[model samples]
Target: MERSLSFRSVSILSPESANGRNVVALGVADAFARHGSTTIFRPSAASKDPFTRILLDAAESAIPLDDSIGVSPEVFRSHEMSMRADIVARYHHIIDARTLDSTVIVGTDKSPITDPEEFSLNAKIAADLQSPVFLAVCTLHRNPDELLATVHACEEAVDEAGSKVLGLFVTGCSPERREDTLNGLHELPYQVWTVPPQTVDPQSEDSIRQSLESFRQQVPADELIQASEEDWNIPVTPLQFQYSLLHQAKAHHKTIVLPEGEEDRIIQAADFLLARDIVDLIIVGERESILERGDALGLTQLHKASFQSPHDEELLAQMTTELCRLRSKKGMPEEQARKTLQDASYFGTMLVVLGKADGLVSGSINSTANTVRPALQAIKTKPGSSLVSGAFLMCFDTHVALFADCAINPNPNAQCLAEIAIQSAQTAQSFGIEPRIGMLSYSTLGSGKGPDVELVEEATKLLREQAPELQVVGPIQFDAAWSPQVAASKAQGDPVAGRVNVFVFPDLSAGNIAYKAVQRSSGALAVGPVLQGLNKPVNDLSRGAMVQDIINTVALTAAQAD
Candidate 1:
């Protein structure tokens, strides 16, 4: 929530025991919308927030509604401080994404809030947003004097937290007590809005608009502050990462060729991508057969997908020529090239190389070798890359880490290891992960000496030589690399020790095992084996991959495409 004084904004929350705060919050949000471009930001367990949904429906620029709503309340319970920072960052992201002219900062209305310090949480979030606060108190179905005490107590809470209270509204009061309540609040120093119960029919737009107009006129314009920039860096949540990945793929509008259209998973993924309009999809299979299969599966969305037959005479001829020319140095004769193009993987890769499509997704029914070999032969590796590598986006609830060399390498030598590290870092960067690498070992800072450990140390040195700006820690145990307490005891005073987001394992056995262990044990969403270091984007899905897996790989592949 950076400086945007041009946009009117305020933070509204119930003080401890207030009722009907959501009503006031909604009114305020509606009022702000009258002025110009307006957004609503609610920070809490936002997975299923009704109020946020309403606001989202009204906002012009739509993202996932939960995108503006922060983490689950239970998540915020343990990760209060870090999650608060994340909430602040989400606010900033929404503002940037919406390019807001106005915003309404709101809180959840439901009870059973898990965070014991609920008021404090909202207070700090408001402080971070650098917006003034409005504490609304409800005097419905209760004694006015007792509610006044709650209001008085809340004054100190917001004030002690240094939140400037712009208004203290006595909202939701019934008509019978309205006059007495207003007279009773005459002694109060802060601005007050004694809003009686709204009487208009729920479906009347004119009444709603009039109420909103009244609320807008009431907000003190002179006190409104534009959001200003702050130096806030927080990890994006898993939900956020997935949404962002799909959103980017949709925005770039890249066409991805899916080679295993015969596989049920791939066909379903084609439907999934097409249903969302995420990308223009091409499913490589015999057109008639794929249509028959799609019909059998009740996947009408697949109607939008273009089906390409690898056996198409003209396409095969072009691919044969291109492949022979690209692989001529390796002695790929015309006969071999023609035979290769018959394979769907090779045909799909050729489509990308020929610019018929932007990227390729294969391997649902093929081996990784079958999938990657065609790309390696025709598309080749980018500059500074001598070998290809694979990275998984280990998406934890509140952050994403890139697990490297997990699929491609078996037991790379020091130089190959370093190259994997470099490629992994660059891949992570492209995917929005700032690479803080942890080169894993059984030893930490020479606690044990072995050839394996020596190889890791040499790889670290080589990685630093190749990419000096990366934050890397090597010859470190996994625990030390992840846990600050463990790092202090094992490898003290190293900046990158405890905060590693990119884990480069010593070998495939370790890398594969580690990612799987964390994924299954902790319930993290592991997306990829994102094939890295290729000149063009081509990803291989596991044979056991689900339909969703195909969709994810296609989306990632599209994002990687130019």
Candidate 2:
């Protein structure tokens, strides 16, 4: 059953009560009979007041029992008032024994009581009943002592019974007295609810009924419930991404090389990836020194990985032999070649050539020219490819497109463009993209004229002749390459005009700017500068790249190596 609970107020200032008829107590007893568990109003009894002959008439009206329950006037004494009220009233009896099981209890002290002991006793009884105590106290602008005594009584009641004091309600205060009353109660733990003076006739029946109804609804139910903290998900921050990638070694698990290993950021990143179980890491440095540095940095828990210095004897010997074989006709001596191969880049390239690592990523601490020069010499280009080029995987959500030769072949000729187109197509296909080669230039079909247009057109022809199964179309503008309507109007018969996924740039200048423009303007994620046409996957890192960038490059290189 959905039980409803409400507050019942007792009028302490009734005309009959002021006239010494004890009508207020009678009214409280009447309320107890009706509500079953009503709060008694306690205001100060000013003197040894005498009961008038009219009290007998008021008492008769107060008794709500089905049959009369007789009680003597002596039982109405200060101590006896607590006991006799309980015995004569059904509501008081249920409340004192705590069997009522109602939700709220609002008690008001309407008149000023001089005896602190009596006030404390009454409050203790209410608190012991285990009902939420709502105390209403009257405040006069100048009587700070009365206010303090009442506040102390309320606090003592709560402490004595181990019950919560929800708040205090201040009544009979003037508008100017409101702020002082609030300030006086501020030191108490309970919230304060101020009752503004009701200037309209307080004895009016309609006003009394309306005030009582409003008071009943204002009683609080159960305490407010809060949301569980466990339901929230931790957001991923940039630092977390960097740390996870480094400690987990996700990049290395796929078999890629990282060039800058000993640096602070790199080591921290490695430690993070390792801690997160993201990837297996391989560092290219002296093993003993790397471990010591890791220990010093309090990354002692990180897993130690294999390291190979470029100056190692076996690597130098192998580099010497390979360089001698490749450049012997140019009169390069075995000792000179050995000394040159002592560089880390040459050593990393040898690791790739010897099938030790799937790919290599360098250039963080070295120039791109220095990093790629060793690979170009040692690994060489793929069969039938005269020049190497670069490509990027541009992704936004699930949509992926390839931008080629953006970082390599500054001014690719017809032949170089053809190779980049074909290679980019293959790379795109490898990454699960259906390659539709768009040989991008400044012109669409023959609508515009330029050397760039001629270069792209000639490359498209060469690509068709050499790789006939591949779809190739160009000398097309960027808009026509990506838009179906434009392609349909301008290059109607071309196979890869509008739906092109692989964009082959005419040269590095256009490719770099175009890819950056597309990335910045469209908010696309640029994934590569993947050095294609190498015998193995050996990519380069930007100098300002983060650890996650290193990890991603490694993963991409490993994917290509596979």
Lowest lDDT sum, 10 consecutive residues, model 1, at 223-232
Candidate 2 on 1-562: residue-level lDDT in tens?
A: 1223433222222111121112223322333434443323222221222221122122233222221222222332345434423322333332333333122222222244344354444443343232344455656343756776766765665555334444555655566776777777678765554544432223455644444343334322221101101122222222222222232334345555555666655666567546645545567777777778888888853454557776578767876787888777777898888777667777677777776777787877877787788888878898987878889877642246789999878988899889999889888877657788888888888888877778888898999898999877777888899989988988887777888889988888989998889888976667678888888888887777666566556656756765
Model 1: lDDT to the true structure:
0.76
> What lDDT tens digits, residue by residue, belong to model 1 across residues 1-562?
2435665567887754333565566566655665567777887744766556665555443667777776676766766656765676577677755557777787644566555567766766676565567787877755767777877777666664445566776777665787888777777766677666543322555755555554445444333222211222333555456666776788788999988888888888888789889899888888888989989999888879888887789878888888888987888888988887878888888888999899999988899999888888889999878899998999875568988788888999999989888888888888878889999899998999989999999999998998899999998899999889999889889999999989999999999999999999998888899988898888888888877678778889889887
* lDDT score, candidate 1, position 350: 88
TM-score of candidate 2 to 2 decimals: 0.53
Give the clash total for candidate 1: 9
lDDT of 2 at 205: 51
Off by over 4 Å in 1: 1-18, 23-37, 41-98, 101-235
Question: Poorest 10 consecutive residues of model 2 by lDDT?
Answer: 223-232
Candidate 2 residue 480 Cα shift, in angstroms, is 1.4
